[model samples]
Target: MGSKQSKDKRTKEQKQLTPEAVQVTHSNQGPRTRSRHLSLVLLGVVEVPPHVWELLELQRLNLSQNCLSTLPPALGQLEHIVVLNLSGNRLTCLPKEIGRLRNLKILFANMNALTAVPEELSLCGKLEVLSLSHNLLEELPVSLNDLAFLRKLNLGSNRIAHIPLCVFSMKCLDFLHVGSNRLENIAETIQYLQNLQILIVEYNNIHALPKTLCSVTALELLNVDHNCIQALPDDLYKLSRLRKIAMHPMDTGLHIIHNPLARPLPQMLDAGLDALFRYLKDKDGNIY
Candidate 1:
């Protein structure tokens, strides 16, 4: 009987030392140690402890695969955090205080239940990658244009129908994924993305391609598959740097007419054609 009692006590003690238990303890830690960096708490839901406010020096935090329903306002106390992953959570909204993280660089919040993003997120001036895929967002804050250092943005599988013009003005943006939305048209202002290299707008309701798209001189990969596009502008052949262009099979057979006197375009066109054809063939094979 005494051995059984002792075993029960030991089991209870072991359960109390779990990471969740540790988090419960750390949450109560005072603000004195708020400057410590690198906190990870994955696979379980736990509220942010009040003690986390003391870790002002934190640079990375991963709380993925948890049942967290909301972020603590005290998260703003981590002024030095550079990478934050909160994916696979039950969060429905973000605290406005997140804007205080001026040094943050990468933010992953995919597979959440977010309905809207706070405009305060635009305040992360150093953010480079922002992933918000598989959410329920219908629109983005116009202030997102203020992210001068942003490079990659993913908004796949959302209910968004229209993109704001301000989104096209991000000068440093290189990659943009807007697949599986309800968009019927792309803003003409997209021509201003001079630095963009890859643009994926597949599986939308788009009906036509904007002629101004040719102005994106640095574009290399453009995916517009499964859309209603029936033709392409002849001027598309002018993009001397394009390497791949993915489109529906019905949109093929359109060739570029280059001015031999201006510059060489055949080499780049050949490479792009090869890549596009390969993609089409692969897609066709899957359809059968």
Candidate 2:
């Protein structure tokens, strides 16, 4: 009788070891190893296993280019997740519980159908790189200004009409791309980005360049093609670090081809940035 009881106990233990449960506890090992990284990129997965949230030690999660339209709120339980890539999905919104990931640093949600982002995302104080390009976002949450460490922000190919002034509060911003939008004017507050390196605002409705834009001394590359800009700010010559100017296909090297730039300025553009600056500073001031 005692021997039979021992056999029954072993059978019960084996029955509890189902495949789904094993996937969570043992990870890839026979029934006890744990996965450190979970990547499901381009698998056409429509849904994630509910037990996946149990992976508290998971550091990176890649679910890009999938068919997932929604995320399980349990995703917030991953306390150690540092990078989360959800790009190229059909998701329309993000769960507010995502704010629970205090350790998250890099988040890529580009190429999705997302219409809104949770304001709670600002809680991830450690986030540095965020890409929301090619989405349907028209406006960003006010709380986004709290991400002081954000370095790269790409909002290109969206329907954003105007950039919030709060975005300039990010002191560490190095690159900013807001091209292909409905922006009619750039705010004067743009000069607040002291560390800015590259600024691309091509294909917008802007009719003129702001004088303050030239104050960003660290700027290296500027692309303002396909806009209604009729004149170039003379103060722009003071930006010593300015390197490239892209206005139109024919206007490759500091040349103004398409825009209705007035007088000798268009002629000076043919002579280059040095010649343009000389003409602007000349006492003659003969602009026609």
Candidates in order, TM-scores: namely 0.73, 0.81
Which pairs, if any, clash in model 2? 26-32, 26-33
Best-fitting candidate, scored by TM-score: 2
Candidate 1 lDDT by residue in tens digits, 121-240: 999999999999889989999998899988998998888898655578688989888877888888888888889877777778877768788788677767676676654544454455
Model 2 agreement with the true structure over 75-188: per-residue lDDT tens digits:
899988888999999999999999999999999999999888899999988999999989998988989899999998888888989986658888899888898888888988
The number of clashing residue pairs in each candidate reads 7, 2
Model 2 stretches with alpha carbons more than 4 Å out? 1-35, 246-258, 281-288
